[model samples]
Target: MEYEAIIGLETHIQLNTSSKIFCSCKADSWFDGPNTNICPVCTGMPGVLPVLNKAVVEKGALLAAAMNADLQPVSYFDRKNYFYPDLPKGYQISQYDRPLAKGGWLEVPLDGYQRRVGIWKLHLEEDAGKTKNENGQRMIDFNRCGVPLVEMVTGPDLRSADEAAAYLIRLRQLLRWIGVSEADMEKGHLRCDANVSVRLKGSETFNTKTEIKNVNSIEAVRAAINKEIERQVREYERGGKIEAWTLEWDEDTQTLKKMRSKETEADYRYFREPDLLPVHLTEAWKSAILADLPELPLARKARFIGEYGLPEYDADLLTAERSLSDYFESAVKAYGGDPKRVSNWLLNDVMRMLNESGKIAGELSLTPAYLAEIIKLVDAGTVNTNTGKALLDKVNESGKSPAQLVESEGLAKVSDAGAIRAVVEQVIAESPAEVESYRAGKVGLMGWFVGQVMKKLQGKADAQKARELFEELLK
Candidate 1:
């Protein structure tokens, strides 16, 4: 019997706030020295009290609104008891029964169709510190302690690894578009833990699931989940029981290793926090947050298709990132050319350049105005497409305008009929044997003649004009 995998994700997005959740320490912990950003409240010192940062709650509300989540009017913090070297406090302050938001769904594109993934809850919490194990000793850094995070739990609605990865890509794009978090997996700004289980096809009950942790990248997430699914299927085939356990992904070996037994919710012993009061988000506050949300990814994609007449594939690529979509719009508005033409340039040449340079679209030296000008040059036959593409590198190096570089480098298209006629006559006079073969019905030599004329013209002649001149002179 075939088995199907059930998958869910717990994605933790670090909120981009100025201060920690319950303290005033700086939230930028990426480059700070070890234990430099900690304070009495964050370090959990004696006789210290915790205070909630209003900005953290506001950012959470903004994300909740963007996700179409039901924001609870009243939510309280609870103490989640656990012991770890990285956790400065013996218990972490989190939301349990009354989370900040619930019952929302995100639509992810899968296999050329849309699938709705249910969001079980999104709650606010504090981040733990980092624990690094060197040669023999373990060092703890409290710099990330007390950092604000919103843990989004998803329902087990995914059946395949591809679906899971697609869901994460959409989720990260939404988070970045809404301006809540960077959601960069490399920097630890966003982290994920995937829970996977497999059962016989069409089974109503779920088999024992294993939680895979420390999957730092999206590709690793898909790989780890698939490996677990295979392992579970083999165990069940051998008539062995699948036990609940926690596992870690070894990226170097491309395998999963058992970490420990999975802990249940009861093991955490959650209770209401005695230090802080329950949060109450007024109706006016929710309305204001909902009003401030920008257009999300899916909505923008639909609009690109409808307004710009772009194909679904082009629209999807353009709307993948907020900055990239903005860049495309700016170029379209500036150039006033065919939107499809601009889309082609961006999706092909511009994206390739960005990837090769290891820079983002926003960070590249090529601005929207410059790209628009280049597209205009190509459309007007002032420069051929090859010269236009090569001009981008020149523009990046010399910081010159497209028109200026074209003139200085003699890269402009040579549309002068007289000038191209001279080169075509020279090619015919130089190659008597080839010319005789062409006259003797070697029709394929027409392309060879055009190529010779273009080489003589230094790639500055319009290819179509050169071809016409070749055909005329040969006859």
Candidate 2:
């Protein structure tokens, strides 16, 4: 019997705010020592009160808008009651009933088609601390306590593991593009928990689902969910019922271990948070926050395809990052030529350089203007294509303009027909045997002749002009 997996992901994103959600302690304690970034307000001490960080609300709203979620006019926080060692407050201050925003969908491009995943919940919450089970003992770190997070849950609209991973990929791109979160899975900035259930392909009613946790990377998410789905299918085939267990993924061994029974919403015992006031999102305030939202990744990618006439592959590569996309647009405008030419240079050469140097497109010393000028020089035959490529490295290293470096390094193209004719004649005179073979119909030797002329001219000669001269002189 064929079975389909019903998959949904709940992602917790750490907002890039300066301070913790409700306290002045540093929000990002990724590098800090245990409990160093904590204060009375975040530490859950006796008689302490919580204060909402205005920046958290603003950034959360910005993400909500980007996700196409409906921003609520009035939202309230709730006390999510749980008793765990890492949760010092004994209850997490989160939004349960009235979250910041609700009801939205993000369009995800799968292998061929796009699927719109509905957002079941999008709310602001405080993060719990970390508990590490080291060698023979457990160590607790509260540095992550009170860290601001926007937890979003997706509907079970995904039918396969690949679709789930694609959703996370696009979500991470959107998060970073909007400048809201770093969304780095390795850094724990963005984490995901996938809930998976497998049922007969034609059945619409839900099956007993188990939740998988501790998947730190997107690849891990894909592998773990796939593994779980297979396990559930086998169990049912043997006439065994699937259990509702919270499973932990063993990334090292590539297996899943039952952690505990899955907890229900009633287990949370959620109630309105008593210490803080409800968030009143006024029209003007909401408008001001949404104003900061930039063009999302998908929208910009579509625009690149429609407006610039770029192929889907080129558009996808260029729009992978916001700065890279913007760089392409600026270069296109400055060059006033084929956008595909600029796209080719960026995807092949510029992207390689950026990766090697650990920099983004915006951080390049070769700005969009410099890039446009270099391509223009190639177009006008001011520099050969090889010399033009060298200029990219030279200009990036010295932060000099393309024209200045071309002049200083004597790298201009030798387009003079007479000058190229001299080199072509010298090549024919030097390689007599090769020249005879070429005239005797070793036509492939034409490329070798061009290479010889280019070497003599120090890669400054136009290969096209060299080829023409070679054909003329050999005849």
Candidate 3:
């Protein structure tokens, strides 16, 4: 019997505010000494009261709005009772029964089609401390404790690993556009947990689902979903009753193993957090926050196609990352709205350099003006295409004008018809046999003579001029 996979993702994103959620301890937990960013309140010391960070509240609300969540006027935090060494308070301050936002939908691109994945809720919560082990003994770092986080729970609308990845990509883009979080998986600022189960075709009820926790990377998330689905299918294939289980993804083995039974809603024993009050959002405040939201990926993609006349595929690739899209637009404007050329350089050359250096477009030193100038030179025929490419590489290292780089590197194309004629004649004289083949209807060999002329001229000749001159001489 065919099986249908049911998947839901619970993504935990650390808010980018400077301080912890309920205390003034710096949320700049990265690159700091262990436990250095902690305060008494964050560590849950006796007699300390938790004060909510207003910035965290605002950012959380913005994220909820960006995800198209239905905002509730009044929301409160709850104490999630649980026991863990990392959770020093023996309970986590979270939301239940009443969360800030709910019933939102994020549009995901799957199988070349757009589908809306339902967001169950986006709730504010405090993060737990990190557990570290040296040799064998476990130690707790309270620095991450009480940090602000938004737990975005999605409905079981995702059907496959590909769809899950698409949803995650879109969600990350939304978070970045709203400026709520850095959403860097490598830094653990954003984490995802998935609930996956398999049901028989046309089955009305869901089988026992397993929760795979703390998948940090997108690739890992896809792998976890696929692995869990396979496990569930195997159990049913063997006529074994599906059972609820919690699992952890082992990065080394690339597998999921059972940890425990799935926790029920009542297991956490959620109650209103006594130290905090219900969050109130004013109409004016929402309006002000809404004004600052940047253009999201989908909107930007449409503008790229409508305003710049870029192809849909190129527009999507250009806007896939924020910095890349920004770089592309700036270059287009700088180069007088030449969309196709900008797209070509960005997708081919710029992306190549970024991938090789392991950096984003924003991290590069090259300016849009410099990139535009280089492209302009290529388009104008002042420098040959290869020379323009070489000049682009030197732009980052030397910070010189494109013209200066061309002159200094002797890369200006030999476009003077007289100068190119000499090289073309030399190539035609040396490659008589190849030229004869071209004259005898082997027209593709024209490219071989073009290459020889370019080589003899040290790649300084305009390739198009060389090709034209070769054809003229051969005729």
Candidate 4:
């Protein structure tokens, strides 16, 4: 029987708040050494209390609203009892029965269709510490303890490994676009645990699923999910029952190793936390939080296509980042020309500069206004196309106005008919054989003669006028 894969993701997004969720310790300790950013509250010392960070709540609510989840006016934190080496508190402070939000969906645009991945639940939580095994000894670092995280669980809506990867890519884009998290999978800003199951095609009954962990990248998630699906399919072929297992992805081997059996929700003795009160988001507070939401990635992409007539490919790329999309629109409006022209310059010229300088679109020295000025100069025949393209570099490097660079450097197009005709006459005189070949029906040589004139003029000659001169003088 043909099988279909069902995938759900439990993603832990590290918020970019200034402080940890329940303490004054630093939120991001990625640059710091282990245990350097820790304190008694995060380490769970005896008789210590955690003061909830207000910023965490606001950011979490903003994300929940972006996902279209239903927010709870009053959501309480619970103590998830688990004894792990990395969990110093012996119980993790998380939301259990009553989470902050529930039931939202992300529209992931795949190759040819869109997949709506539903959000099962979203809750605020404090992260556990890190553990590593080395030289037959286990080492623990508490620096990550108490770090603010929004645990978002997605419904089992993905049908294939590609869909799971696409959902993750879209989620990462949304997170950064909304300024919630860096969402860098390699740096652990966004982490995912995929629960994967497969069933016979046309069957609605869900089979036993396996949880795969330690996939640090989207490509790894895709590979691990595909591997697990194949394993379950093989089991079905053998007429054996599949067991729910927790597997770890070995990056070096690109394989999954059985870690243990999957744990049910009952395994963790979850209870309401005694230290903190329930989160009560008043109408005004919710409004204030939602007010911070900007036009999301997909929405802006659609607008780019509809409002500006950008092709879907161009729109998708331009909206990959919020700042870049803002830059594109700003440039378009400033140029006052066809939007596609600005799109091409941005995608090709501006993007190359950004990549080389390790800067984003907004950080460019060549501002949108300056880019528009250059394009206008090109449009009005003040500068040749090559000169206009070179002005991008000159303006960026010198941080001067494009018009100023054109004036100071004598870069304006040689559109004067007398000047171009003189150069074209000189080029034809210097190349008699080529000129004869051109008159004898080697019409392609016309471009070469124009090239020689442009070369002599230092690329300042009006190409169209030179082409006209070549046609007239050659005949």
Candidate 5:
């Protein structure tokens, strides 16, 4: 029998607040020395009480609004009783029964259709410290302790590994676009725990599921879920019992190793924390956040397709990053040329440069006005497509405008028919054998003749005009 995989994700996002959730210590402790950012409140010292950061709550509300989640006017923190070397308090402060948001859905594109994945809830919590084991000694850094986090739990609405990956990518884009979190998987700003199960394709009852913890990257999330699904299916087929467990992904081995038994909700022993008061968001405050919400990725993508006349694929790519979409708009506004042409240049030349330089669109030396000029030149046949691309390299290296570089370097299209015909005549005169072959019905040599003329002109010729001149001169 064919089996279908049921996948749910619990994603933890580190908020970008200036201070820790319940303390005034700096929140960005990723690169600091061990425990430098720690204080009495985060380190769980005796008699030190925790206080909520108003900024965290406001950012959480912004995220909820972006996700279309219902923001609960009242929510409170709970003590999730657990013991780990990194957790200084021996219990994490988190939200339990009354989370900050609930009942939202994210729309992801899958198999040429839009699928809405249900968001079970979003709760605020504090991050644990970092634990390092070196040479048989264990070290714990409390710098990350009390760092603000929002855990977004999704329903078991995803069916396959691809769908889960797609949902995650879209979610990250939304988070970044809304400015709530950087959601950079590499830096631990966003992390995922995937719960996966498999049953017969038509069966509705869920099977025993295992949780894959701390799959940091999107590629790893996809691979880990697929591997877990396969393992469960094979075990069930062999008449072996599938038990719920927690596993960790070993990237070097490309395998999942069993960590421990999965913990149920009761295992945490959650209870309301008496130290912190309930967070009550006023309607006026929520309205203010809602009004400040920027255009989300999906909405921007739709607008790109509708207003810019871009294809769905192009719109999807252009709007994948907020900076890239902004760049596209700026170039179009400055050039006032075909938006599709601007998109093609960005998706091809600009993206290639970004990848090679390991820089984001906003960090590139190529300004929007310069890129607009390049597009305008290509559109006006001042330079052919090939010359235009070459100009991008010069602009990046010298920080010169496209027009200045093109003029100084003589990269302009050789559109003068008189000058182009002279090069065509020289090419034909030098290649007598090829011209004879062409006249003898080897018409495919026409392309060869055009290449020779373009080479003679140093790729500065309008290719179409050169090709026409080649045909005329050869006959």
Candidate 6:
């Protein structure tokens, strides 16, 4: 029987709020030493009361709205009972039965097709602490215990490891662009747990899934799913029932090892937290937040086509990153509506420099004003496109005025007809054989004479003028 892999992901993102979810401790302690940034409330000290951070809830709702999820009128926190050294209180305050948002979808673009991934729910939760393996001892830090986190659960809509990886990447991009989360997998700001199962083709039901926890990066997520799928396939071939289990990814071995059996929902014994009251959001508040949403990547892609008259491919490329699109627009505004030239410069010159330097385009200090100034020099015939590119690279590095660079570097194009005439005359005198060949209809030799003039002038002579002057002297 042909088997198909079904995958779903639970992504945990730490919000960028300044304070802990239920305390006043700083939330910027992610990289600090263990137990240093903790306070009485976050560390779960005896007889301390929890106070909710209003900003965390607001940010969570805003994120849910961005995903087009259905926001609940009211939601609150609950206690998730568990025993782990990483968790200080042994009971986490999270949303259980009623999440902040539910039943949404995100559209992921694949090779020549778009796949819709269903979002099961999004819930606000407090983060647990970190465990460190220092030499031979395990150390616990309570600094991150009360940090705000939003866990997004997706439906079993992914059919392959590629699809799952693509979904995670797109989701991370969205979260980062919104300024809600850094979504850095290496830093553990964003973490993913994938539940994967295999089923017969065309079957309505799925087999028991093994939930793989904390597959940090996209590559790890794909590898874990693939290894688990192969393991289950082999078990089926041996006439064994695939059991529901929990596995951890072993990066060195590049395989999934059994951690323990998977726990059901009832195992946590979730109950509503008595300390925190149910939070409510009004419709007017929701509408105001909706209006504050910026143009997302998909919408900006369409706008680039319709408003700027750019090609679909260029539009897609520009809108892939928000900062890049912003930079392109600023350049267009500075250029006064010349979309095509701006697009070429952005797609070719700016991108080439960025790629070569291994830096983001927005990180450069070359503003729209600077780009417009350079393009004007090219349009006015003061410099050819090649010289213009060189000037732009200089400005990119030194942040000097275009005019100043032109004067200091003597990069000004030699537009003097008289000077170019003299150089072309010299070239004709030296390369008489090539000039004779050109007159004999060896048209390719024309380029040879023109190259001589350009070389004589140190490439300062305008190429078009050099070609014209060469032909005149050759005749």
Residue range 1-475, candidate 6, lDDT tens digits? 8999999999999999999999998986856776887888888878888899988877888789778799998887899999888887889999988888877888888878888998997999999998889989988888888999999999999988999999988888788667788888987778999998998789998788889986888999999898888888888878988888888898888878889986665588899999988888778877776676778887888898999899988998888777788889888888885687888888889888878888776788677678888998888888777788888788988999888888898888998989988888888788778878889989888777777877887777798888887766667
lDDT of 2 by residue, 1-475 (tens): 8999999999999999999999899989877788789887887899999999999999999999888999999999999998999999999999988999999999999778999999999999999999999998999988899999999999999999999999999999999999989999999999999999999999998999999999999999999999999999999999999989999999999999999986664588899999999999999999899889988888888999999899999999998999999999999999999999999999988998899999999999999999999999999989989999988888899999999999998999998999999888998889999988988999999989999988999999889999998888888
- Model 1, CA-based lDDT: 0.90
**What TM-score would candidate 1 get against the native?**
0.91
Error of 4 at 237 (Å): 2.2
List model 1 lDDT by residue over 58-140, tens digit each.
Answer: 89988987777999999999999999988878989999999888889899888767889999979999998899999999999
Error of 3 at 187 (Å): 2.7
CA RMSD of all predictions: 2.5, 1.4, 2.7, 1.6, 2.5, 2.9
Candidate 2 off by > 4 Å: 263-266
Stretches off by above 4 angstroms in model 5 are 263-269, 431-442
Off by over 4 Å in 6: 263-266, 355-360, 398-410, 425-459, 471-475
* TM-score for each model: 0.91, 0.97, 0.90, 0.96, 0.91, 0.90
- lDDT for model 6 comes to 0.85
Predicted candidate 4 versus true structure: per-residue lDDT over 1-475, tens digit per residue: 7999999999999999999999898889888988899999999999998898999999999999999899999999999998999999899999999998888999999988999899988999999999999999999999999999999999999999999999999999999988989999999999999999999999999988889999999999999999999999999999998888899999999999999986664578889999998899999999999999999999999999999999999999999988889999999999988999999999999999998999988988899989989999999989988999999999999999998899899998989999999998999889999989988899998788889988999999988899998898888
Please report the TM-score between candidate 4 and the true structure. Answer: 0.96
**Which of the numbered candidates is closest to the native, going by highest TM-score?**
2
The runs of at least 3 residues in candidate 1 whose Cα sits more than 4 Å from the true structure, single-residue gaps closed, are 395-411, 430-448
Candidate 4, which ten residues in sequence have the lowest lDDT sum? 261-270
- Comparison by TM-score, 3 against 4, better one: 4
Whole-model Cα lDDT per candidate? 0.90, 0.93, 0.86, 0.93, 0.90, 0.85
- Tell me how many clashing residue pairs each candidate has: 0, 0, 0, 0, 0, 0
